[model samples]
Target: MTKKNVHTVPSKGGSGWDNKVGGEVVSHHHKKETAVEKGRSIARANEAEHVIHDKGGKIQQSNSYGNDPNPPKDQR
Candidate 1:
């Protein structure tokens, strides 16, 4: 089954950050750290990926909670 990924992105109007699942906003936080924490929890629970975006809406990083199809070779 395809897991729905969670994303922490800059909110509209640029006031805060938002935790989104499957393109739907689940929660909002004034700080990016808080939003990332929330998003990580959701991603862990769902066994999905957590995608973090920069202020400019560009993808900054991502973490996989579920089984990855292509894991990095450097993983130990």
Candidate 2:
């Protein structure tokens, strides 16, 4: 399967998240929390990776729903 990533990133000119992939915006929202939830759902449905970014556009957290090449040290 083709691997895809869903991201919750700070919007360009507003307070929210820009769901993106490969630097392309796929969706937008007005609330980070909502966006994060949506991103998680999307990632789960697609069996992809969900990445959340902070207001500074820095990666905050990531969760993999599909096969991860390098999984975490702990499964718990």
Candidate 3:
């Protein structure tokens, strides 16, 4: 989905202390990670697909779609 209407879902991996602090009953939107970090996470996810392709386990790398269209910083 485009950034304008990006969908966010709470993670199932809530912590042990969330309830004690009266944290939101559900987790907040997962802040998107930086490109390098996203790539790493994507790689691990793709690895799962490789397991199904038993003949060869290869995960194509993820491309960095890069920053937001209207980033806060100006071109230097």
Candidate 4:
């Protein structure tokens, strides 16, 4: 199966946020939280993985939206 990854990254010049897919920017937001939410929505719609990064460009969190091979016990 193909992998879909939606990422929330920091925009240049310390302005705001950027949502990207496959290294291409898809949308820009004025807030990190908003960007994260948008990324989550995109991930869910596409059954992809959402990746959130810190301001320092370090990975902060990741969540699978759907088609998880090893879902949580509660979800299963």
TM-score of each: 0.91, 0.83, 0.20, 0.84
| lDDT tens digits by residue: candidate 3, 1-76 | 1112111222346311111012232123234233224323433433311011111223223222344344456779
**Predicted structure 4, TM vs. truth:** 0.84
Q: Could you report the Cα RMSD, in angstroms, for every candidate shown?
A: 2.3, 2.5, 15.5, 3.0
Evaluated at residue 7, the lDDT of candidate 3 is 15
Query: Lowest lDDT 10-mer window, candidate 4?
Result: 67-76
Q: What's the CA error at residue 66 for candidate 2, in Å?
A: 0.4
lDDT of 1 by residue, 1-76 (tens): 2479999999997899999987889999999999999999999998999999999999999999999877989856
Error of 2 at 32 (Å): 0.4
Relative to the true structure, candidate 4 has a C-alpha RMSD (angstroms) of 3.0
- The lDDT for every candidate, in the order shown, is 0.92, 0.85, 0.26, 0.89
**Global fold similarity of model 2 (TM-score):** 0.83
Instruction: Please provide, for model 4 over 3-66, each residue's C-alpha lDDT reduced to its tens digit, 9 standing for 90 to 100.
Output: 6799899997689999999888888999998999999998888899999999999999999998
Question: Using TM-score as the measure, which candidate wins?
Answer: 1
Worst 10 residues of 3 by lDDT: 48-57
Q: What TM value does model 3 have?
A: 0.20
Residue ranges of candidate 3 with Cα displaced over 4 Å: 1-33, 48-76
